[model samples]
Target chain A: MTDLNPSRMAMVPFVSVHDMMRIVNGDGVAETIAAIADRIEADFLRWEQFDKTPRVAAHSEEGVIELMPTSDGERYGFKYVNGHPANMGRGFQTVTAFGVLARVDNGYPILLSEMTVLTALRTAAASVVAARHLAPKDAKVMAMIGNGAQCEFQALAFHHVLGIEEVRLYDIDPAATSKAARNLAETDLRVVSCKTAEDAITGAQIITTCTADKKQATILTDNMVGTGVHLNAIGGDCPGKTELHRDILLRSDIFVEFPPQTRVEGEIQQLDADHPVTELWRVIAGKAEGRTSTSQITLFDSVGFATEDFSALCHVHEAALRTGFYLDLDMLADPDDPRDLFGMVARADT
Target chain B: MTDLNPSRMAMVPFVSVHDMMRIVNGDGVAETIAAIADRIEADFLRWEQFDKTPRVAAHSEEGVIELMPTSDGERYGFKYVNGHPANMGRGFQTVTAFGVLARVDNGYPILLSEMTVLTALRTAAASVVAARHLAPKDAKVMAMIGNGAQCEFQALAFHHVLGIEEVRLYDIDPAATSKAARNLAETDLRVVSCKTAEDAITGAQIITTCTADKKQATILTDNMVGTGVHLNAIGGDCPGKTELHRDILLRSDIFVEFPPQTRVEGEIQQLDADHPVTELWRVIAGKAEGRTSTSQITLFDSVGFATEDFSALCHVHEAALRTGFYLDLDMLADPDDPRDLFGMVARADT
Candidate 1:
């Protein structure tokens, strides 16, 4: 029989921020992104087996806190994340996250890890996964319109996984562009810091707009987006946030992670409720077509979903266990007899 | 300016099972229960200030996992809990939990703690808080049916907070009764091990039913419960799981923590949709009646509300901080510049 004592079943593996960094650096960020992307693909392929729901969110004056939960009948996962756009001025990250993965059979948490860094990696990987099928064939030149926290990961995921040789970066703030250029200085990709959004998308086949504003701003107008390019729009993910003009959404054949959630938080929020967007999982599962024609304007309305977090958590759990980079936290209370919890507390008096 | 480095705002205080026990034992269980009851009462008095919602649950064949979240516009708290009735046979706790408390202003967590032990403390405290208002004056005896993990805490909370001087314990399993009797031998209250449920409620003015079976079990028959006795039904807190008979519910003046939730999960699930049950917060706020006369039967149909967890989290956060009985967990990622997350990870390569 399994030991039902505090010494045996009370500990849960926890990967701290420091340990997460170690795991990423040890395995290489590019490699981690590739592995996570593969896991996301595998999960997407079997999407019908999982239970899904729109995230539960508590919106406040300052920001919103959300709990995104999903389960695959065998494993359950959830991420607690917050987005406070004004937090950056107060010396806090605009977004911070942590997540837990548990066994569905017993509901005991198996792994807990910091997800702020992992989210960036998975977001970029998810974009690349969409691009691999939706972007034009042999696409090599990409435009990144947000030179901020997620820019480098998007640039690297494309450079390493999809073999994009050059990246055109642009930001409203020139300092952010300089920072991205300086960070990518060591990489082999030809990094060009452009002066404007138009300059950034010049001759690019993939345009990724990931700005950090929390308002409706038309970063990509209909005229600016040409045919035969994949637009990965990820920044406008809240109720009142949008990055593309309504004309652009009307012009492109949009694909989304989940329709019910995307209709509220994705760029499609500006379009009619019945605007007819394709579910990305259908394309991934080979049930629908992707990039049907070379001249098609394919746009991936990318709002990060819970399944991607589940995949990232699965990857982090395995990597942490293999590399021994996690702490066993005494997060659960296991009494010798489950009915004697009071006895456990009373006996501690000794 | 506030420091934006990873070392500054990234750490959250984590109170483990060992640390929680230390804090509880250090303060004394009776004192801790009293303090928690005070906090719960205080929060209940101002219940309108909170953003309340029924717990979001994911049920499976083996068990159910739930997330209970609430905020008072300034602070946010949520608990992750699971209930697996067959877990005891598999050498696991029937229920286990953990919770997080965060600052709503910035959406950053301030505390994370194991709540298996704390839940016992708060559940007992909440029961006492209810009994204080609903139980007949000068009631000194409580009949505790199904003496399990929560029996001793209930006994102690009644003994210390509600002036109950004696407790009658009875369970289908004699071993569970003996465990409760043995655990309570050190207390000042009189503990009696009864042969049956009828014998247990012989002279008791308050009755608490908290069995573990996930089915309709008539622990309290309509004829067995006399007039003027307050019933605290907690075990039957999920769909299709009910304790008292429907006839018993029709005769009692039902008071619930949250009516919308209790209508689905509490013992009142057996009743009609618009059963005219009273909200407990109204009584606490002095806006509704509790027990009108000595012959009135008052039932507290508690499915456990999110506000109770929020109050318990507040108490634990304060106590943990006061005693310094917690570990600083590097849970959040705070880069030197919020947008320079990639730079932070890149520099960690060194």
Candidate 2:
């Protein structure tokens, strides 16, 4: 920054992974998820004010990297995230992310934060948000299929926010289920480690399928999903990858984040192009119906969206401010005279 | 970044504005521009290997914010930039930018750099690249129509690279011309500050126009341009902006970086949709002719491209490595167990 206008405009508050953990600890896990959910829901209600776009993705043989950008006329935010299926074998997370939030008026970034933890929190919060309006009024049990990285976050989020007392968990690899169960040992929720997807979904009002696969696989059959249950299909996100049988989608009232994107990447890709689905924002805003009857099967086809990331970044930004767990990065150059940038660089050392 | 892969994979090298100065001064400014131009040209030679896209811009009344992303199979890079002409009045730069270079294989950022200074360097380098191929062999004196932020850099680049012995400068405001003159006073090249645009182009064979404007405006006329001269039309960019006359465009043999983008944003937008123009990369690759005759008018319609930025980043990444002028940013999260992201956060406290 220059001599006259130095600190405020040039320095951006950056929250690292270490600081993210500290902030997460300062705010309890489930409570933070709920807080992000509240922000997501609030942003969803006023979705019309935003300039939205589907995440721009670059696909390679390894996996994919994506940039999700959105601006609410006032402030702009974007997340840079990658999904590499083989990363887990190399001791790397299948998905890692970071995000930035900038002012729309001057296009200056205000906050730069690690979003790996925040993405997990936001994904769970978004599920809870959809379940709030789509799930049964008296829902108490959540069956988590493919209990891996997102398992505990989802379980804790549902346990605290949706009043789910028990989580029935199952994964193809029994070791994963055991890890999730052990992690939830301290939590108040009753953790049930089941053997099969059918066993996992037994007597549960909400079922979450988030198995990781590079190719298409039906983790859940139509016979496994009962009426009056809310299904959160998360792992069938990219092309050529899906989790539920086509018949199951036929029976459920599908809700989506952004239909144009969800139609191409979500579980709904198995259905027709014009298949009627409710935009989740419309339901959140009360402009459309959620769950009409107890017999209705509701499914939130969750591929994730930019606005949810935007909401999460904003929520975490406020949390960082309150907790004082941020470092200022001198990422932008400011000169005494805007037109004399070369002169600033020339006289920098002096 | 974690314990197992903490040093190599966990920490990202971050170059700030102060360090960028160290780099520019360490390598003389003219030499740095020439090196960046070499990288840009090398990338241009292998342009087919890159995934290219025009920048995604979010426009507001105040200015516009843009994201320019590209990948060359092995590496990926993107820049975040904003153009707010009114920022100069508010004691802020009209344009500010930052960029990131990441491994395409795993999507981990290898370099994070402040591009405010680099952008100025890359812009000038790109111009000289065009002039080298399009300008006359005996071209000596260069005319600078806009003496703003980009003026002095252009003059120095041409002086060092193309052997432009003199620079004739002009701007609507005399102070801008004076500032540019003062900045270049230490150099060996003769600096002539002119009262009018016509006076500036009197004896120069190469002309550069980079005045800032938000709408369409003609800074140069067809009659003012002479035969055997090279025109570097840069000021008129964006959808509604251009700096050259339609008649001037008709007379000149135009060459552009990318035809699709130049058709919409460059000075060639004034010409017909099917007006014949040579792709600059083809010319660089020897697929097309550059200067058929010294008498022909050559115009390099320079709208900067993503590959140019990618080259600049790769170049600067190497330079920062050699100079050791970068800070390590703990921007990514690496957990021991790939699927145990929640566990990592839960245990980060200890």
Candidate 3:
């Protein structure tokens, strides 16, 4: 007979941000990102195995906080993320998050880690993953129009993964552009601060737009978009929030994470429901075309799906376990007698 | 003028099960529960101020995992929990959970805490909060069906908050009953183990049926119910999972946490969409009728809502902060150069 005390089942494993940074640094951020990209791509190929749904968002006057949950047959995961566009005024990042990975067999969380930094890494990795297939061949020059927290990651991802050599940066906030340039100072890739979005996209083979605003900001007009440039629209992810002009979407062959979610929260929200777009998984799985021709414009409408987080979470779980960087959390009740959970608390008194 | 080195946010505080137990033991569990009950009531009264939505649930063949998120003006909170009926066979508890509490002003997580222990506390506190207003005056005995993880908490909260002196417990598993009895050895309230649900409710004034099964189980029959019995039906929480017979609901006045959510996920899922059930908030606010007559049988068919969690998280946040039983988590990117989030990743020479 098993003992009925729950004190024995009391520890959970947790990885801190410092530990995560150490792992990212030790593994080489680019290599770590590449690994995560592979995991995301592989997961995307088997998209039907997941229980996918549109994220549940609670919109307030300041911003929105959302819960995105998904599960395969054996594992379950969810991410808690908040988007407060006005947060910079209060010294807070525009987006912040954390997530959990759990075993579906027993409903026990196997891993819990900070996802703020991981989201940045995975978002960049996901963009690169899509661009590698969709961007034109020899796409060495890129335009990044956000120059915020996500700008540097976008630049590095392209430089390390897609072999982009030059990046033109533009932001409404000049300090943001200066900061992005300063961060990329050590990298071999050339980074230029541009005065306008049009100047940033001049001669760029891939243009990535990621401005942070809760309004309908037409950052890029159709006339400014050049042919053969892969447009990664990363911001403008909520209802009533959009980045690309509707004309740009009409001209580009668009690809998205999940079609159902993208229709509401992606740049495609500006387009009609009947608008034809390919699911990124179909392109990754070789069923659909990504970059049909060198002259064709491709757009990756990334609203940050749950499957990417699912992949990133699994990768982090393995890394945290192998590196021994996580603290034990008593989040599960392991009553010696599994049926006697009440006794676990009672034993705590002893 | 703030440094944005990318990882410079206020630390996130955490309260583990041990930390929560210390707070409860130090402050007196009953007092802590009473305090939380007050918080829940206050939040419910200002319902229009909150951003409320239905929980996001991922269901599998074995059980279900859910993310329940809600926010008032200042703070946002969410819980990650799973319910697996077969977990006992694998030596795991039937349920486990953890959650986050974040600031709405900046979208940064202010606290992360284990909700397995806290869930038990909050669920029971919510039951008591409803029973105090809906149950008959001078109610002193509770007939508790299903002696599982949530059984003891229900017993203690009623004893501590509502002055219930005796509890009649029944479970299909005898070992579970023994565990409940053992856990309550330290409490002054009397515990009675009964052979059947019918035997348990012989003369009890409040009948709380909290069985654990992921299927439709008629734990309560209409013939077994009595007048003036405030039935706290807690176990029937999913689409096809219900505890009481449909006839029982027809005979009693039904109340719920959130109607739209309860109509789909609570015991009332067995009823029609236009069923004449009252939101528990209405009764607490004195906007609707509760127990108007001694012969009235009121049912609080609760499928635990996010508002209750919002209250529990806020209470725990303040308590944990005062007790200093929490650890700080670097869950946000506080870039000294906020735009240079990539630089926060210390690059490798390789």
lDDT of 3 by residue, A80-149 (tens): 8888877777666777778888888777888888887899999998999899889988989999998888
DockQ of 3: 0.54
User: What RMSD, rounded to one decimal, does every model reach?
Assistant: 1.8, 1.6, 2.7
lDDT tens readout by residue for model 2, A10-124:
8889998888888988888888999999999999999999998878888999988889999999999999998889888876667878899998888888998888889999999
Question: Candidate 2, A59: how far from true, in Å?
Answer: 1.4
Give the per-residue lDDT of model 1 (tens digit) for B23-78.
99999999999999999999999999999998989899999999999999999999
Per-residue lDDT of B11-36 in model 3, one digit per residue for the tens? Answer: 78878776776777778767777888
lDDT of every model, 2 decimals: 0.92, 0.90, 0.84
What DockQ does each prediction reach against the true complex?
A: 0.80, 0.71, 0.54
Q: Note the B-chain TM-score for every model.
A: 0.98, 0.97, 0.95
- Runs of candidate 2 with Cα error greater than 4 angstroms are A1-6, B1-7
Instruction: For candidate 2, write residues B254-334 as lDDT tens digits.
Output: 999988888988998888899999988888999999989988999999888888899999989999999999988877877
Q: C-alpha displacement of B273 in model 2, angstroms?
A: 1.7
Clashes counted in candidate 3 amount to 17
Clashes of each: 0, 1, 17
lDDT value, residue A251 of candidate 3 = 93
In model 2, pairs of residues that clash are B236-B242
